[model samples]
Target: MSRAIRSAPSAAAPTFAALALAAGAVVAVLLGVYGSVHQPTGRTLTTLGFSSLISMKVWLAVVAGMLALAQAATAAWMYGLVGGSKSAPRFVGPLHRATGALAVLVTLPVAFSCLWSLGFQSYDTRVVVHSVVGCLLYGALVTKVLVLHGRPTPGWLLPAAGGAVLTALVLVVMTSAVWYLGTQGVPTSTGY
Candidate 1:
């Protein structure tokens, strides 16, 4: 490859990472806002005074749980960009960035809803775990943002971020599986 052409991938990298960080930031901020607002009092689900189609729990879960899932896909998409064990194609780079960014975008609503759900006084032990992990994951995402800002995007960072995100997802999904299965489960989130 010529020197001029070789520079293209590197130049393109910062843009991709910036997009990922921006999307992630939006997701995290929205979630943080929602987490701070949710305060369910009675077991009954209430309306948000919007269209008649939405319920509070449904809206919140969709936002929080879905955001978590979207972030997971973002991690994989990042890995796809990084293309460990194989050199990532030029086309794949954009795809990776796009997917990662999209995942974060899709997650924004869920994140806020999650935060909103926590506002409710009636809480479960599982929720506490979810909250802590959510914070840690968000913190990791912030680190990812800083990393992107400080350096050009590298292939390895994708997997690292993905691994962090996947770990969080594991905790979120299989909270009680461990004790039930006679093994230690992942720790719960504390809304950090």
Candidate 2:
């Protein structure tokens, strides 16, 4: 007679991590709500050497959105999700992280200015899309960070979160910054 070998039971579920993710998501959504309802202060924070703060914001948004695209591309290459080499170089991972961090840094001032000076105004179609994307962008970023730090989430989770962040950032740039630059003209408005 032969006896079957049994594997040990797995450790307890990561309840704390799950809870943290939930809390982060909630906080992000609440922030979006607050931004939406809050009235915009007419005054804007200026960037040194830039014609106006809005111009700086536009330039930063473009750079951040481009970096986000690069992140997505590198991630795809790493995962072999695109038509390219079956594996990405080891440097790709570090590059992705560095680009993402830089993108976040670049966007911080732009986000602060948008929320502080414009709230979530929607006086036109572009503005409406921009407002909605802005809300989603913060939420997506929070979710992406949570998943990045969370314990062993599903394989699809990280890519999905990253994709969402990229999409939202692109939409925000297209609808607001790019549109403003193309139609209304750059540095559309000046100091308070």
Candidate 3:
């Protein structure tokens, strides 16, 4: 067990860590600013055969959010923060990385559609919350990825980043997807 753990590669180079941190911060800030200021066009692009694009986005976000939840759980297990397991199975690391990648992949289209079509809105309380949370969600993701790649990172940084990512995703789901479903009724086409 110890040998397996020891076999994992050491932290990344200091130069890489610095670059990741700076680049990640800049990207996050740009996203936040862009989301905040871009005027909503009040139009959306739909997936093929979907009655409404919003419904499709909702479902996609939910799936990504659920995957993110799995990533968080696996992370907790890896850190011995949950499941009472002293050592995480080898599969846990791969699962975490795979799920994380999938979550990000699924979210990309939704984010692009939102940013291109909606461009942030706040006509109502829910709209405001949703728009803000959406921006934060991407920001958190960038930070999490940067920290994950950074060498000599603090022990607490990874977990904290993961927690932030999970929180942001949950908030995005609640404010947008869940709220839309509760208020607008789930579409029969998607059966969600």
Candidate 4:
């Protein structure tokens, strides 16, 4: 009988995941620093026939939140957390990708507008919370993407990163869009 030997698992995967997470943290910190130091342009954007820039941002954030919710659902389905099946349906993967892409697309304009016009305001508690979490949202997103693309990562890493992204996104939406809707109500008219 021959003796069997098993090699130790490679350490590179965890190291890569750590490095990616660190890079994401750096990106987030840089964004926050830039937002803090740079003077706001106070310039507002008009788009999609919104009555005001704030209204536009509010709506866009709402859209992004909805898309994020869809992303979460699809992710759960893919992982078989929601569905009873051992394997996800093929459509779930595409739907997840599509919703994730759409969420990013819908969020970009709002993020640009915020950084350009607001520049990480800190006058009020809500503003401060919103500004900080806004930066974290991007950071979490970066980490999630990096972990996803970097193969051989720890099985738990991707889900952890994704959960962080989702949490940050929910906070951002709650602090901004939900607050706006509560105080100002929905915009009835569009610029178009």
Candidate with the greatest TM-score versus the true structure: 4
Worst 10 residues of 3 by lDDT: 1-10
Which regions in candidate 4 have their CA more than 4 angstroms from the true location? 1-9, 45-49, 188-192
Candidates' C-alpha lDDT: 0.48, 0.73, 0.72, 0.81
CA deviation > 4 Å runs, candidate 1: 1-85, 120-122, 152-158, 173-192
Candidate 3 stretches greater than 4 Å from native: 1-25, 36-51, 188-192
Model 3 over residues 88-141: C-alpha lDDT tens digits? 899988898899999988888788778777776778997777777777777667
lDDT per residue for candidate 4 within 114-157, as digits (tens), equals 88887989999999989999898899889888877664677777
**Cα miss at 149, model 4 (Å)?**
1.0
Reference-based lDDT, residue 15, model 2: 54
- The candidate that achieves the highest lDDT relative to the unseen native structure: 4
Worst 10 residues of 4 by lDDT: 1-10
**Clashing residue pairs in candidate 3, if any?**
12-151
User: What CA RMSD would candidate 4 show?
Assistant: 5.8
lDDT of 2 by residue, 57-145 (tens): 88888888789889888777777676566666778878988999998898888878888888877688878778777777777888778
Which should have the higher TM-score, number 1 or number 2? 2
TM-score of every candidate: 0.46, 0.83, 0.80, 0.89
